[model samples]
Target: MWDYSEKVKEHFFAPRNAGAVDGANAVGDVGSLSCGDALRLTLKVDPESETILDAGFQTFGCGSAIASSSALTEIIKGMNIDAALQVSNQDIADYLDGLPPEKMHCSVMGREALQAAVANYRGEEWVDDHEEGALICKCFAVDAVMIEETIRANDLSTVEEVTNYTKAGGGCSACHEGIEEILMKVMDERGETFDPTAVAGEIKKPTSGLTNLQRMKRIEELLEEIRPNLQRDHGDVELVEVDGKYIYVKMIGACAGCQMASTTLGGIQQHLAEGLGEFIQVLPAEELARRAAMGA
Candidate 1:
């Protein structure tokens, strides 16, 4: 079972703004039932002030999807349209405390709905067509442009992370290479190295077993290599615990509350997996504690 946070459960069981807003002037619809997720967002904006007077939504999907949509309406209700447009997928996740890594795509869907609604209000052409980029994920109808944008916004480095945030490489396993190429291109643009071995289907098994202490030492060394880059951004990562395949770390400084923290941890996990020649997961220390407290 997915370990849902209390806030997520709160919104899911009794979703706020669960229906269409009366007298809504803007409407945005995204996703399809065929894709297993869909959302319709309605907004009543004050024309002169351009502020969202009211917002509501109706979504079809899992609890995370419903909660994300509910949280989105609450987050944008009183904000100016311009500010709402600046809200990222990470913002929605943060609003709900956090989402399970596997369910991050639900937050991404919410962000897209908000953008579509704003564009509708503005009478701007908001096309979901794959005209700007190739169709990368046939299963999810995720295009290259969306994948690239999500990677850049979240600092995603591995195909698995991309799947977490965009659902791009999560289906059929055919788009893994395409996703890897996109990750490589984005990392290259950012002057960061992309480890091809980090691709979801290509990770190699550890050649030899090491003691827990040796594993911890190696993980620390790998983290030290990436510390400079994170430090430059006023963020840092601290090793917390090593439990089997899970490496728990604490994001310190500016990284702790960062909207992109999950993907930052994803990047760290990718680096460690490549260096250690093993498939491993990196998670936040807080998340570990939360699960333990819940007995999840």
Candidate 2:
């Protein structure tokens, strides 16, 4: 039997908003009839608060997608606009407790439908694929604006909080520390104080403890240690950074072109991140490759 998250099991059985709204103020459609997943969301707004008064959805997909859509509706029925907007893919995933790795895409569809609905409400169309600020967080196909806005919300009280608010770090944890940096800057600007605590036992070297050259030397050593196994497979894995509990890496070789590159990067990341903290963020090599490609 496919192992379902307990939260997933509950949502699948008793999805809250399973039908369509009688008179919707805004409607958004995503996915497709032919696509494995499709969603139609009809929403009612609280004119004054811009809050969601009621919402309902119709989904044609696997259990996760269907349940997620149903659950999404229930979540937004009475949430204010800003708060509802703050409801991230992570929040949905958390509400459902957990999801299988392969089926994670299903829950993502629920979030997409919501984005489309909100875009529709604003009378805006989906932007061009190559438009500026359009880096699709490939794992979930979510855009940067979504991440930036999600991060800006004070809801993300700390670095890991973004994982609870957005599934960004929950994927190939590449941007884990980057997201944290963004949040830290935001908090500072708002005169908010966020803890700089590292995950227990994670290597949190003081800023002045290791000079730039020493840090580079340390990373080189770490890479050298893993170079053999990587070369055994005609590959190279480079550790980009070791921050707190997150160990970011870049993989080169068969992995660079492999369809499972993300998977490979995640496996490597998981191994390294675990070396430090019980809770570690492993970033994929693809992110580094992509950045390199862009920089070049």
Candidate 3:
């Protein structure tokens, strides 16, 4: 079962600003009942000062979604619209003392609503439609742009993490690969590496008879064998660490910046898995460091 923080429960049970604001001048509507979550945010803005005088919401979803919408209204009640646009989904989660990772999309919806409302007040065009070929998760109507932004905003590294933050791959699993590709692109932009094991979730235990040292030695030998091929192209790979089924390596030289780095990593992973007779995932050294920094 998902654990609900106390603040979340408080807002859910007795949501503040629960109805439409009287004399509301700005309105933003997002999500859909068919998608299982919908929200309508109404704001009363002082046109002269460009300040939000009041805010209210009506939401349709689980407890988390309602609480998130409530929290958003409370958060921006007295703020300027420009300042409110800076409110990220993480800020909403932080306001509620943090949300369950699985429920983060609630906060994301809240953020989007705020942007839409602000745009409405400013008479700016805001389009949230799912363009053809741009939609990434059909089940949730999540698009690639949303997924990419969420990944960058939250430093998301895994397909599961992306699902939790944006609800992109949470249904049917068809968009898992697309989510992973987005993750890789984001990581590459950040000059970090991604671990495919996290995406595929196919880690295997070490072979029955091989000791830890034996496994480590075999992995290093396989990496050594792979190095010469990379070296032929003025690139190289160096083993960094071995933890369970994950073998972390650093790609140096041209390979580090290669557009086909993921493909090269996949080749290395396939080679190691075949040689070791087990499912082994090749990861970039930066992935290990990122996990450490996150205390995960």
Q: Which candidate should be chosen as best, given lDDT against the real structure?
A: 1
Candidate 1 root-mean-square deviation in Å = 10.8
For residue 7, give model 2's deviation from the true position in Å.
2.3
Model 3, residue 86: C-alpha shift (Å): 0.6
As for candidate 1, its clashing pairs are none
Error of 1 at 253 (Å): 4.5
Runs of candidate 2 exceeding 4 Å displacement: 32-35, 128-296
After the best TM-score superposition of candidate 1, give how far the Cα of residue 29 lies from its true spot, in angstroms: 0.4
> What C-alpha lDDT does candidate 2 achieve relative to the native structure?
0.64
Rank by TM-score (best first): 1, 3, 2
Expressed as tens digits, the lDDT of each residue in 73-155 for candidate 1 is: 99999999999988877789889988875576788789889989998999986776323356788665577888999899988
**lDDT of each structure?**
0.84, 0.64, 0.82
lDDT of 2 by residue, 36-98 (tens): 688898898766788888899988787888878877887788887667767766567667875
User: Which structure is stronger by lDDT: 2 or 3?
Assistant: 3
lDDT of 3: 0.82
Runs in model 1 with CA error above 4 Å?
32-35, 128-296
Please provide, for model 3 over 227-282, each residue's C-alpha lDDT reduced to its tens digit, 9 standing for 90 to 100: 87677545899999888888899999868987667767877886688678787789
* TM-score: model 3 vs. ground truth: 0.48
